[model samples]
Target chain A: MRTRSVVAYKGPSGASVEIVKQTFSSARPKPARRVSFLAGLHGDELEGVYLCFLLVQYLRRLKETEPGAFLGEVNVYPAVNPQALCHGSRLWPFFSVDMNRLMGEPAGNSLPAGACRELLADLKGCSDLAVDLHSSNQHLAELPQIRIVKDFEKKLLPLALQCNVDVIWVHPMAGVFESTLGYNLNRAKVPTLVMELGICLRIHRDFCSQILDGAIHLLHHAGVLNSSRRPRGEIKMPLVLKADQVGLVQAKRAGLFAGRVKLGDRVGKGDKIGDVVDPVRGETLEEVVSPFKGTIFTLRELPLIYEGAPLVRVALDGPDER
Target chain B: MGEAVSLYKNVWEKGHFVDTLSIVAGLHGDHLNGLHLVSLLSRFLQDVEDGRLPGFRIAGKIQLFPMVNIQAVMEGERLWSFDNLDLDLAFPGSSCGELADRLCNVLYKHTADSNYALLLDASEKRCVSIPHIQLLQPDRSLRRAARYLAGEIPGGGPDRFPGLGIVRELQPTPAFQLRLYNQWIENNVCALVLAGGRSAGIDPETNGALLANVVNFMLAVGVLAHATRKAEKGEARFYSLENERRVSASHPGLFLPEARVGESLRQGRKLGELRDIYSGETLEELFAPQDGLLLTLRDYPLVYQNETVATLLVEKERRWYWPFS
Candidate 1:
């Protein structure tokens, strides 16, 4: 195992943002393939960072205990935006730029600019498969999910299935996806899968363990590891939920939102999902109801909400059940 | 039935095809001055609507949004409850973005057609400031109208509210007022921001003075059919944001202020002192950068490094009658 640091950018304070790459190689390597794992693109999303750290630890232990057990190489970029991570901000603190949108753009001297170039350069001609992990906003708690571009679903689904996530969401090759690092890497002939789970600024231990085990299993599937140990959890087919039927519950009036249902709770149509109460008067102003009978996938963790702000997101039941 | 209802919607409306003035307040929940000012204006307009004021027909419609950040108002906080975002900072917001974005988008759409927009705000808790108006890129007519209104309001003195109007070149951030200025500029709307009051409680006299200024502004802009007072003549001191002075803490500790709001200070005057909270040792002394009027003073005892302790309105070379010593 070896560690290297690639200088991403020089901050205004003269501090350089160096993306640390920790690589574990197989002893029996003879022109072996390489798979990359990246996390913390959004500074505040640290679940993937913790998961990558654990994965690196696991791979390092495996490499030391039994040499020649793996086939190729595993590269991990644990925290990409150091400046943002410092302030627990989702966007780069100085310029307030979103790193995800800087892919394929000119690398300026601003926040995330040099970092993007360094990352793209590292992925070029050096990686075979890539996994980009992220988390929802701080107010949102999401189920462990894998998102794949629509065009790459056929080629990436089997690999995504190994991750043991709760859902597999396929997004079209349009909008913000075109500028994402996963999409950029995919266009570079490297298949990349995006994984999202839990909340920002906080680590979900169970999800981290699940993703770590999934990464190990993915390595085995990619012929990197020859171990017989499979992914720990049962390989259940994640629900292939569509984007249209996802009911978004928004606030009708500004108030303190108190959700009646917790994450992963199954609710029927017209059920009271939550209540928006006036913070000053202590009176319930609005009662939010579930539009479709389904499981609550992402609920607002924060209590404050305004009119038109989404308070809950429910994964709807399929047409057959509806 | 003791049921609660949200009836404050569309509080005041009059006239059609005439110029519209959109007034919004409570972007931060603890900013009570603007909320009180608009509340009084709404009641006054409601009286007109009920025919209580005979032969007084408003030429234009007034849209009064009393509290934009309702959750913040209820919680008695500065930022919105969801994500703790400052509503003022979220402007020209995204439709599919977070809570603050959506709220800003909604507000923008509501006031998109107004000919004039006013943002009323107050100083944060643990701080106090003299009432002032901030104008961004004001033209000759807007400047004249603003000055006309400023002359009518009786501030704590001749140089308090309506007395200090600053013309800012641009906002440093993508603030709500900046966005409104941009939107209004595109549609030829005059946008102005009036900041006043303290964090603790509402001052009715200040609200009344502000209300008179608004009424006078409406008359000056041909929004009101009748003028109540004679045209008073006085100059409203205008300065650029670049000329303002800010004193920040060099050390984090309990802050003891030496000057009061609206007080004048010469160069080398001590502003405040930062001391160790537990040890009670003096950490650092803050001093004035120039001879200026103290517009804002830090009220909170505990302060962190780099936090603003006071803001001074630097004196200009061109001076008018001196009212305060």
Candidate 2:
């Protein structure tokens, strides 16, 4: 395994935009399949960027010690949108647009546009399986999850089970489709799995290790790795959830939220989730209660909340299949 | 004089639950026109609530967020204190995001479910304009209702306020107006923005006109009983997005304006002039791109290359003042 850098786009001001890809591969005859992992499409989502680097380190050791333990080709795009990363903005700076929204647009129109173009061109025909890693926005912390278009569930569900994430979210069809990297690659017959963990602009080592381990598990399941690095636990099928009105709990008051329940915590109906407190008077304004018997899928990291703002996302627990 | 009551307070009150109108103003600290308008409304609504105004029936609730950005308002700055970010562009803010983000989310939450929302906005010190209504397009009845309210204002003929109303196709980004537009689409809140005047100084006429216009809008939206004093729809100019042209300086120099806001211009007329700041030699004459109304004129001169000098409203659709329609 070694590191490689390619100039994805050159800015008008002569600054070269690059994508650093760490590749772990076998030197022998053609590997079984090519899988790629990408992170930092949004500059602020740094969790996946760190995860990719850590995975690269693990892969390097695996290739050095047990060469046959790892099979096939694995490429990691540690940071895709460097301009946004440098500015700590969610979208590509200067262009002031979400690069994720213009993936299928003609490149060379602008810097970020050109980078998206180069990204698609680089990954085309190279990846049989693709995973786009991301973190939730700075406001909300999310449970480790795998998301795929709802239609691809049957084909990708078994593979998703191997990711070791806590939840499997089916992508809602309401949002932009063709403009996203996962959708574009999926349309091209490339199975792309979008994974999200933790919060944006920060690094969580535990989450990163879990994600890295999940990737290894998925690769091993694909017959690409022969390592004895067994799955951390029984590869249980995740509770597949859809974003709906039922799961969303909005704040009833505008104040600082003092949370009583954390992410991944299970609660019964009518359980106290949090309470909004008026910081000036130090009085509890309203108590937020859970409406279902479920596990918290997403929790607010920043306490300041407004009336009707989503306080928590709960994924209802289903009937036991044990 | 031992104790005093604060004029700056969150005075949100509810009347009969006929309709809910969330009136938000002063999102930016320095843009005081909105604050002034809110102040006027607070007094008027207080009068109506106290039964002081005869025949003025308060039909619905008025949620007044007079000082949405209080810290910024105190500092007299356009942006919130969090990283000096513009609150106007921090829409659909997050519950767990930064201060600006949470404020934005608060606004979104309040306005998302309202029957109607009125956001008051103003430019910073660089520019100024007459009080006018700005509507997001793809044409909803809200645009027509705003035009109706603009017509109802006291002193205005067909082309009176110059760009009396504007129809903009707002991008669905982080902007406050855009966030409100999203609510309009999903919840039918009929969101409208009353963007008028500029910072550095306040115009009483613009403030009064805005105050009247908001009241007129309440009547038109069925939040108040129709009265003879209500503004009648009249001949006025509505500028589409294309008509609003922001003319920037082509070269760095001293800029001299040949025309001010509310002035009409013919095609190819000199809008401004640029001269060498040091040498006092004529450099360039900025001309109107087309026949139009000057909506916003830059007050603070001393120009830089690419600095906006003025915004003209061209390619307009003007409605004639038909007294007996």
Candidate 3:
């Protein structure tokens, strides 16, 4: 096990922040391939951080029991935005800038920009495959899923299928995704999978363990783990959905939202999903309904919602629907 | 019924209205300085149209968009409170997209025919800046127009346009590509951003200065005619990206700034001090690294470690063939 500081910056007083990466490599002179696991890009999203922790723990045990089983290398960057993670905020505290949106740009003395550049430089050319894990924000709980841009869909879908996620959504490209780490890495010809699971600031143990199993399976598939030490598990095939196959339910009035449908629950069209009620007036402002016969993959966890806030996201039923 | 994002353009037209000058403000709802400045301009233009101002007249066409992000302004937020999306970053926008996107598209289309555009912008939230013109990824023609507006050209005298003597040229970052200023420039409109004051509020002094700057820009661009004063020739100080220095806090604590924006300072001058948040003990004193003008000062007292507290615009030194030069 080797830990290295990829980037360090001095604070105004004297304190320093460093982004560190831990690597576990095999004893063989030349291993099969290297895999990189990254989490905590947004400080608030902690599920991925716990998943990385689980992987680290499992790898440590494997190295202790049979060191030769670690065939290639596994690099874990558990916390990419250390300051944000420390502050428990979604953006870097200093600049309030999203580090994920600053990738592939010139590092021009700004702390967040420089940190992103340094992290990208460190990750590039260091691994054969990479997984950038994230979680939904405080408002919504997302099912374990992999979102791939249509541009990189062909390259990422096969690898995403190995991750045991509930869905593999291939969406069209937007300008906002251009600066993302996943987009930049894929553009550089290094295939990267972006896994989003659960909600921010909370850990779902079952979800973490499920993804951990898939990650280990991926390590073996990538030749990072020896065949003899391959983990046995059934990898679930994910429902592949296009951008238009998803239905979004938004609040029509500002009020308290009471969600009736749970995540992963299948519902028919016009099903009562939730209601926005004005407590002061003792009136139901709006009753939200499923737009199509589909499975609810994302549901709003927080009750207080604005008029246009998204309440639920459903994977619509179709020929491709499982 | 869906609420529409409506835009109101106050236009003043006169003889030979071939050249059009567009002035925009309130792209971010919280940035009140620009909104006030543009409102003042609108009133001034109305006065000119009414023949109230004896010496000033509308020579060409001038369009004033006093409140671009009306919804945000109404909500007292920097972005649209509904979606928290920045209208400024959704330029060349989608007509069929969200409210922000549709608003941006309408604004872009309305301003497409402008020969010159000036955006009155407030500085970032929790920060105040001296009134200055910012040119992002400026081409040769745009630079020439900015120089003219700043009174840097040979015909326009220096100090003629008070509060706009400083011109900063910046290289647009990747995220800047979506900004309205960048999009306008790409479409051949000579556009510049005048940033000052702070967000969510208005400062009379900063707004007054920005108003004068915009009026002068209109005058320079031949959109407004002045019969009394003759144009004088002088220089406008120009700074590149390297000239700006950002000073950040070393520790998370209460930041008390001793220096104000637009103040001239010598090397090693005290800029601010940082104290512990809980104990209130003085942790560090920030000092200027060189002789320059303090362009921006953080207005917020509570700052996290490594957050920028101030930015200084260092004066450029002329060099000769000598070794020191």
Candidate 4:
């Protein structure tokens, strides 16, 4: 595996800040199909970063065991927000701008500018495929999913769907989606898919491993590696849930919240997901309830509470858009 | 609901669109929002584009074009541009002003005509907040209507909505626009009413509902009687100009969200728990410390305790100014 660092910024520290890019299967290339993965643009979202690291390690070991494991080349930029990681944060320091949004902007134009020009140029040179890894900052958790821009299904869906995540988001140029590195590559006509796996803040071991498995599956599925991985079952595409129907119940008064729900429970209207109480005062302030009928996918585990803080999330079936 | 225009009348490349626009007087690109709303409202657009959006001559009322800010929209930003000239602030723009100012001038021209209502429809950027409609009354009836509009709309009214402790200071403040809408009402007076569904980038259904609220409001205020548009369920509240609330991550650490948008809670509810990436020591617990409706929760976790996680559209029945009696 080849790991090269692309300088993104030259700081007051005199040393240039570089994004580490790692590659597998470059030695005996066969009509090299370069599939690239990037992660950790937002300092706080860490799951994708873990996946990046795991995949790199996995590829390293696989290349040795089975030469075929090193089919086409896979490049990984494990940590894009090194500054954030250095401080244990999500966004690039000082700029605080979401780096994902900075993708595609010309080098040295914006805040940190597009200092990744040479790296991006090389990425364009390998315009076969690209994947940007990510996760929700907070308030949402789910099985790994893929977001593909509109009309790329024919060329990219098969590649994207192979990741083995639960849902596939099909849309045109969403906010973070459009400015993402994957999107920028796609704009250059490189087939691209954005993989969102697990939550941020920490690594969900199973979720993290899921991504590792997905990368290998992708290599096999792409015909680069002749692996025995099989499609588990018929792929399922979930219906998109709008933002509003999803609800969060925060506490009205302050207390310790003891949630009585798991991560993925079905929630109906008026479900008691948790409660807020003053332990010392020996009185309850409010009980978090689901206002609309939906399924509960994530619940806050923290006990110490405030007057108003989110406790539970419910995804409801929605009405017409307008 | 959004339209695109090239300020620079001629074709220009990305390299010099800015300096070039200044010279030749035009730039290209579209400033857009309401994507999630529009995608969700594909059916609604089918109605509008397919001629199903029925509207008759407003007797003598006027209709203005929507203003688009391409530059700001491109960067996935809410503000006007990198320099930050809000579309509202740059209104009534000078001929030689910046692109934002120029667009503002364009807006002033379309809206300058007397007797026009401005329904500024928007959404919370994250998710799980009330859909709000605002109206600032012109005393008595408008005041009553502002209250009523505030109450009638899903979220809150033109001004003085509960959730937003932060607000935009502009000429057509909700009441100002409300006054504009009712300018021809003679006795009713004009006012401003803003209704928001899902905030930017997240909830499409709520966003669609918010847009529908405006359309329904237009139908009602336009008094297209018997329009058959079902009234929305929630009431609109009001807030002051000083009440704009912003949401971001909490604790500058990785934001591992324990929930999705629109979760319910009691006071002292845990929104999510933050921990150090290496040490695993619990840092801060994101909690709801008040009684209210949550407007936004993080869709992406990675927070800084001070970072705005989720915002609540707080409504204390009495403390709030209920326009609808």
DockQ of each: 0.09, 0.05, 0.20, 0.01
Per-prediction share of native contacts kept: 0.07, 0.00, 0.11, 0.00
Interface RMSD (Å), each candidate? 11.3, 10.5, 5.5, 18.6
The CAPRI quality class of candidate 4 comes to: incorrect
Stretches of candidate 1 off by over 4 Å are A1-140, A145-196, A199-203, A213-322, B1-14, B43-57, B82-85, B89-109, B124-126, B137-145, B152-155, B158-162, B169-188, B227-234, B315-325
Model 2: lDDT of residue B303 = 57
Q: Write the per-residue lDDT of candidate 2 for residues B105-165, one digit (tens) a residue.
A: 7677877777888877775346776666666653646656666555544554335554345
List the RMSD of every prediction in angstroms.
9.2, 8.4, 5.5, 22.5
**What is the TM-score (0 to 1) of candidate 1?**
0.61
Candidate 3: tens digits of C-alpha lDDT, residues A235-265: 8888889998888787767788999989999
Q: Sorted on lDDT, highest at the top, how do the candidates line up?
A: 3, 1, 2, 4
Candidate with top TM-score is 3
Summing lDDT over every window of 10 consecutive residues in candidate 3 chain A, give the lowest-scoring window. A8-17
lDDT of 2 by residue, A46-109 (tens): 9998998887888888888888775688888888888788888777664446677777764423
- Candidates sorted on DockQ, descending: 3, 1, 2, 4
* Model 4 lDDT at residue B257: 64
lDDT of 4: 0.52
lDDT of 1 by residue, A145-177 (tens): 888878888888888987778888876665445
